[model samples]
Each structure stands twice: as C-alpha cells, then as structure tokens.
Target chain A: MLLEVSAEKRFGNFLLDAEFALDCKRCGIFGPSGSGKSTLVHMLAGLLKPDRGKISIAGTPVFDAARGINIPPEKRRVGLVFQHSHLFPNMSVQANLYYGWRRTRKSDRKIGPGALTTALNLDHLLKRDVNSLSGGERRRVAVGRTLLACPRLILLDEPLTGLDAELKSQIMPYLKKVFTEFDVPMLFISHSLQEMRLMTDEVLIPENGCCRKRMSTEELARSSMTSVPRSYVNLLTLRRPQAHNDIWIYSWGDEKLRLIEPGEPGDNLFELGASDITLFKRHPEATSARNILPCKVVEIFGSGGRVGVELEGGGGRLVSQIVHESVRELDIQNGSELFAVIKASAFRKIC
Target chain B: MLLSPQDMQAVWLSIKVATTATLVTAPFGFGIAYFFSFARMPGKYLLECLVNLPLVLPPVVVGYLLLLFFGQSGFAGPLLKFFDLRIIFTLTGAVIASAVVGFPLLVRAIRIGMDNIDIHYIQAARTLGAGRLDTLLTIILPLSGRAILAGMTLMFARSLGEFGATIILAGNIPGVTQTIPLAIYDYANTPDGDRMAMSLCLVSIALSFAVLLASEALARSFRKGSADAP
Candidate 1:
C-alpha cells in the first residue's frame, strides 16, 4: 500500500474519524463541503496532526500517536497542493519551483526543475512573479513546485475550486499531464464528481467527518447521491461531437444524442441523470424528447422502494429509476432489450 | 546657528549609539518574532509577555534591572571582567540602555509582520520539503520585510529619544556616554543653556523625522514589490 491512515480528531462539535488504505497510484477523496475531506488529507500530508492515531505513507510511519511519533511535514516527503495556490509571493516562479527542489536530497531527487518546467510549460513563466500569474497559471506553478519536491505522494485539496470553467479547463490538462509524466502517487480531494471522475479511478467518500465508503470512480459516477428516488444522475464520457445551432449531437455507437446546451469546441464528456431518462419496452414515436436509444438492461438494483436499472444502449451506458411495480410488470432482467428516452435539456457538458 | 563642539559631540554620540543599538537588536528581534509567530511551546504567552515587559516598564526601572544584571557589583560583572570588558557608563552601556528600552517595539513590529503572513505559505513550504529554518530564511524573512523595516525605524527613533534609562545607566558623561537626550537634559537644567537646548531639540526632531521618512519609503517599496509581483 502506498498510504494507510487511521486517525481520529475532534474540532469543537465536528469529529473527524477516518481510516483508509490506498494502493492506487492516483486515488481521490470525494465528499461534499465540510465532509472532513480536507482535514483527512491535511492529516495525511502531516500538515495537521491527528489527535490520536497513525498515518503511514509508502510504508513509512509518519505519525503514530500510540508510540508518540509524529514526523514533521518536511521529513514526511509528502507534497501538498492547497486549494488556493500558496506560491511564495516574494519569489519568482522559478525560485518557488526550486525552493523545495533545492532542499531535496541529491539522491532522493526524482523529478528535476528542467523536466517540471517543460511538462508544466513553465518556460516563459519562470521569470514572472507569482502574484502576476493568472489563476490557471498559479495552479500550474503550484503543481510544478510540488512535483519538483520529489514527494512520495502528492495531496491535492480541491485544487480546482475558485476557478471559472474556462480557467479550470485550462489548468486541468496540465494536471493530467503532470500526473502522467511524474511517477509520484497523488491523492485528489474534491466535492465535484466530474472532477473526481476526470482525475481518479479509485475514490474514498467522506461523510460527516468520516470515510464512509471506498469505491471505484466508475461506480461513483453511476450512483445517485440524492434522496430524490425519482431521479438519479448518470454520467457519461462525451465521444465525437457535432454542433448544430443550440444543439450538440454526440455520437453513441450508430445512434446520436442531442444536448440542448451550447457546446464548447473541446468539451470532452457530459453527465445525464438517471431521472432524466425514461425506459420504454418498445421504441416511442413522436415524443418531444430529442434522444431515443435502443438498449438492453444490464442490471437492476433496488433502493428504498425504487429500482435503479442500468442499461447499455448504442455505445454508452446509463442508469434509470423506475417504480418497483414497473420492474415486476415489465419483467426487466439482465439483457432485457429496451429503449431509453432523454429530453433535450437532460444532458450537460462535463468540461 | 552652528552648534558648540560639546553639543555636536553629543549629537554624533547619540547617532552612533542609536544606530548600533538598532542594528544589533534587529536580528534578535526577528528571531523572537518568528518564534512567537509559529511555535507551540508551553508558556509561550508568558515568554511573549516577558519580552514585551520593557515596553510597559518604567525606563528607570528597566535601567535599574540592567544595572543589577550587568553592573560591576552584579552577577555578570565578574564574568565580564574576566574578559577585561567594562560596559557600565560607557558608550556600550548607552547602547545597551537604549536597546533594552526599544527591544519590545522592535519585536512587536516584527511580530505583526510575521502574523500578517498567511499560514498556508509556511505550510506549503514545509510540505515542499523545506525545514523550519529553511522556511524562515526563504519565506518568512523575505515576506516580512516591511514589518522588519517598520520595527527598525521605531526602535531607532525610540533609541534616539531614550532618556530615563540612559541617564540612569550611562550617567550623562559628555563626549563619553552622554547622548543627545542627556545633553539636552543637561542644557535644560543649566542657566543660559536654553538656546542650546532648543537647537538640540530641533536636531533630534529632524533626525527622527528623516529616519521615519526613510523607513516609510523602505516599507512602501516592500509592499509595492509584493503587490506588483506575480
């Protein structure tokens, strides 16, 4: 395992009690606001000490309250990319990136300044002061700085928050590039499902200051989190796109789904909630919905009197919520062919 | 009018003592400020209060305390004499007196600057593998530049104007330990010494104003540099 953390802390009324072990090179912690996601990661990074428990990174015990061992953050060799870029305002971009790089032991250095500067496209930015960089640029610099530190694991605490869609997109690719090019492990934290889906394959979900569940990102993308059983949001990766005034047609196998939102040129994927889809045993005719896909039922799961039907149609997969009575009446089962209908407004871009 | 030789000597002596005191105390002040800014030691508040005691204590009481510690009959006197060094009633004594009176102002200004720095920056530095001292040298010191300048200015001005402590310890020995304040005190007490006293008072005010202006300029540049940085 790359990391294992079992710790408990209390902050006034909030209690952060979480325990999880991660082996994946790129894992994510997904939760809503105040879910103790940040607190958990901060503990992992050794920025915040656990009141009582243990944290081990790469099999090295960074914190063991029972043994009275709490390694300092600098000695932990775990890098942190804060939600707000904490680039040294007094230093140039180059200096900030090298601040940790220079301090890292010669033998311990894996990623060098030259490699990071190139991967992050920090050539022109090297001489610029950090305050002058745009939000996207600052985030990129923060990533580069962390990477150059040669950390065993990198913890990103909602790094994409406080950014507009355009800037987020601009910085997202660089993050992906850095993660791919560098060999360091990364634990991403975010409240946005779309961001988690984009960045991680394994996810740890936090609830009320505790890690409640650990699941694959793909599984998380399919599950409906809301209590409203009538609707369950299902996410999909957008394939080839063809724009048609106010409507963007996305290819799904031999079928095409029309999205009502204005499509940006380079949008990669989109989300469609299960509640937005209606299942028909036979193809419907003359409906106001812009999308009708012939599909087969893959699985049926029940939750609180409602049945969630997973379907595969054309080239994509979707989940739909149907009444339990309908499931018994239609005799839905695995491989039961059906048609799924989606309205024009049902699809939203994921950036 | 041109000052008499004795008064000019006093002005020069004050300048030398105050400048030396400020320069000597600044680094120590920054170190204490940095410690107070971050460390979580027990009795940290007590340490802070002790460091700040001079700012509240009467100047004569501080001088008396210093005399008890460093005077010929005090505990440190033998240790000092072992090195053939004498501090009492010398220019060094005058510098020490001014510094003790102004130490709190220096540390307070520096602490304010250190407090203004975002904790996240220090945290970031640590996670990036920079140790505490490394972070302080590269991050805290550079970022707290403005505060340090302000503290130094205040300390310098206070040292220049230091009276009660200097009189008590340095004994107003003209051309030896007597600074501008002591000289002014002497002139104010002597009959027909009014003109000289007034002239020295104006000189002191002008000197303090110049120091304040220079320090302000330095602080503004630091602010501007950070604001205009990327």
Candidate 2:
C-alpha cells in the first residue's frame, strides 16, 4: 500500500476521524463540506497530528500516537497541493517552485526542476510574481512545486474549489496528464462527485469523518448511491466502453467480460452486480451483441413478480432476475439456455 | 533660511532613530500580534494587557520603567552592561523609550491586520507542504505586509514626535538625542522663539499624514490584487 491512515482529531467544534488505505495507486477523498476531508489530508501529510490512531506511508510510520512517533512535514516524503494555491507572493513563481525542491535531500531526489517545469508548462510562468498568477496558473505551480519535492504520495485538498468552473476544467486536464505521465500516487480531496469522477478511480467515501465505504469510480458513477441494489440482472455482463474510467470498460451483468488480455487479473477489476441486467428466454441471434453467455434458471428470489435467477457462465457463477410469472410460464427449470440479453452499451468499463 | 549644522544633525538623528526603532521591533511586534490574535497560549489576555501598557502610561513612565530594568542598576542593568551597553542618557535610550511607547500602537495595528486575514489562507498553506516557518515567511508575512508597513509607519510617526521619554532617557542633548519633538519642546521653552517650534510641529503633521496615506494606499492596492487574482 502506498499510504495507510487512521486518525481522529478535533478543531473548533468539528471532529475528524478518518481511516483508509491506498495500494500505491491514485485514490480520492470524497465528502461534503465540514466532513473533515481537509483535516484528513492534513493529517496524512503530517501537517496536523492526530489525537489518536496512526498513519504510515509505504510502511514508514508518519504519526503513531502510542509509539510516540510524529514525523514533521518536511521529513515526510508526502507532497501536498493546497486548494488555495499558497504561492509565495514575495518570490517569483520560479522561487516558489524551488522552495521545496531545495529542501529535498540529495540522495532521495527523483524528479528534477527542469523536467517538472517543462511537464507542468511552468517555464513561462517562472518570471511572473506568484501573486500575479491567476488561480489556475497558481494551482499548476503549486502542483509542480510538490512534484519537484520528489514525494512518495501527493495530497491535494480540494485543489479546484476556489477556481471558477471553466478554470477548473482547464486545470483538470493538466492534473490528469500529470497523473498519467508520472507514477506518483495521489490522494485527491473533493466533495464534488463530478470532480472526483473525472480525476480518480479509487474513491474513499466518508460517513461523517470516517471512510464508511469504498467503491471504484465506475461503481460510484453507476450507483449515484441509491438505497435499492438496482434490480436483479438476468443477462451476461457485456464488455463495452461505459464501464471503465471515462470511455467505459465493458462490464457484465453476470461478470464475464468479452475482451483480450485484461492485464493482471485482479478480482476487483470487474463485478457483475446481479442488479443491472435484463434477461430474455428467446435467443435473438443477429444483434451486434458481442457476448452471449448461456445461463439456466437454477433458482428464483425476490417478490411481487420480479425474481433473481442464478446462472453458471464459464465456471464463474452469476445471478439474474426473471419475473415470477415468466419463471412459472416458461417452466424454465434447472437447465434451460435462457438467452441473457445485455446491450454492449449497458456495460460500463469502470477499471 | 538654509538649515544650520545643528538643525541638519537633529533631522539626521531623528531619521536614524525612527528607522532603527521601527525595523528592530517590527518582527517581534508581528509575533506578539499574531500570538495575541491566533495562538491558544496561556496568559494570552495578560500578555496583551502588558503589551498595551505603554499606550495608557505616560511616555516618561515607560522610560523610567525601561530605566528600572535597563538602567545602570536596573533589572537588565548588569546584563546590558555586561555587553558594554549603556542606555541611560543616550540616543539609544531615546530609541528604547520611543519603541516602548510605540509598541502598543504597532501591535494593535498588526493584531487587527492578523484578525482581518482569512484563516483559510493559512490552512491552504499547510496543505501545500509548507511547514510552519515556511508558511509564515511565504504566506502569512507577505499577506501581512500591509500591516507590517502600517505598524512601522505608525511607530516612526510616534517616535518622531516623542518627547517625554526621549528627554528622560537621553537628557535632551541637542543635535544628538534632540528629535523633532525634543527640538520643538526646546524651542517653545525659549522666551521668544515660537517660530521653530511651530515649524517643527507642521513638519511632524506632514510626516505623519504622508506615512498614513502611503500605508493605506499600499494596503488597498494589495487587497485589490488578491481579489482580482484568478
């Protein structure tokens, strides 16, 4: 894991109790205002100490209350990009960029100034006074400064909050480009679902101050979080563009993906929640449907006409829903190829 | 009339004393002001009251208090003397008295400035990987520049017109510790030379007004820039 944190802190009347782990990958902090999101990020970066609990980055203990280890911010190889930009007005943009870069110990340094400045398009901005830079430009500079610090993980606290919507879009692409080009893990903090959806795949959802649950970006997008578990799906999960990050990764209603070399097959890369599919008995053959996994009505569950059916598609079992009336009328018992009809469009690529 | 050598010396000495006092005490005053406005330290209220004591106390009382601690046999008497420092009956002592009297106003201005500053800015700095000191130097201080400038100007104006403390500590030595306020007092004390005193009074008002205007203008411009900055 790139970062692991469990902390509880109090400021004024607000209480911050947050805990989560990110496996050396980009993750996001999503919560509403006063949800202790900023406080969580601050604690991760060693900017604020927790009254209880512990935090570590790559197994390096940052703050451990019982062990009595509190690493200072400068010593923690965690970079933070504040929502407010925090540029040094007295210095030029170049000076602000170099501020943290200069503090990095020689042996541990990774990304250098020239490379980061070029990547972030900071060469032209170096001459401008930090106070003179616009919000977007200041944010870019702030991100670059942190990157140049050669940190193990980056912490961004609602980096887009102060900017206008258009300017936020302008800076969003740069952040994506940076994330793609560089290997550094980042913990993006934002209450806006739209912003979180656009930037990160791994989401840590907060209940009060603590992370109550975790969901992939695709799950978060599809579920918009409703109480009911969508509906019992009765078709094969399709492989398509709507299931992944932006374009979508084809996911199955039954969980079988029709694709080639999915790379490092982790169980979490795909999930066919028994709720998103519709099943049909008559096998309509000529549709542009790329996947036609065969399933039998093993059992039926749910009430008032709607029923969930269990299916065995390619060793991995899945459940689908068929109406109670259809279940009784078709006499679709243990072994019948109830044609699972899933549109390739319905499959969202979430990985 | 072209200014005489003694008049020119008084002007030079006044400038030097005011500048030295303003620069020397500025950072300490900012620290005190920030502590008073933001920190949760114990005895904060008492500390604030002590800092503002100079504003209500007579300038000579301030000077005598400085003498009680900084004089030949005062609290800091031996400590200062250990460094071959003698504040009694010197221009340095005059600067000390003026700084003490001016400190309350300086801190008051800075404290208000610190209060007016948005705490969000500081929190934002912390999220930017800036440690406490870096945030202070880079974020807090620059943002607080207008306040610092205002405090310095206020202190200078008070020091230029300061008389009671200067006379007691520095013994009113002409062309040395005799600032504009001391010089004005001396000229007015003479039987028939009110012109010099009136002229000095006019200059003091002009100087004070100029500093006040400049600081306000700078502060307004700074706030405007922050607002317009994207």
Which candidate tops TM-score? 1
**In candidate 2, what are the lDDT values of residues B1-230, reduced to their tens digit?**
63456666777788788888898899899998878887887888988999999899888887777777777777888888789987888889888988888988899988887786666556545544567887777767776777777788889888887877778878788876878777777787898658766766676777778778877888786663333233
Name the lDDT of candidate 1.
0.86
Which pairs clash (backbone N, Cα, C closer than 3 Å) in model 1? A129-B230, A130-B230, A131-B230, A132-B230, A232-A274, A232-A275, A233-A273, A234-A273, A238-A269
Stretches of candidate 1 off by over 4 Å are A10-15, A32-34, A66-69, A112-122, A221-230, A243-247, A253-255, A260-267, A304-306, A325-329, B224-230
Candidate 1 DockQ category?
Answer: medium
Clashes of each: 9, 25
Native contacts retained by candidate 2: 0.23
**C-alpha local distance difference test of each model:** 0.86, 0.72
lDDT for position A223 in model 2: 52
Every model's DockQ, to 2 decimals?
A: 0.65, 0.25
lDDT of 2 by residue, A187-213 (tens): 888977667766788888877776657
Determine which window of 10 residues in candidate 1 chain A has minimal summed lDDT.
Answer: A222-231
Q: Per-chain TM-score of chain B, candidate 1?
A: 0.96
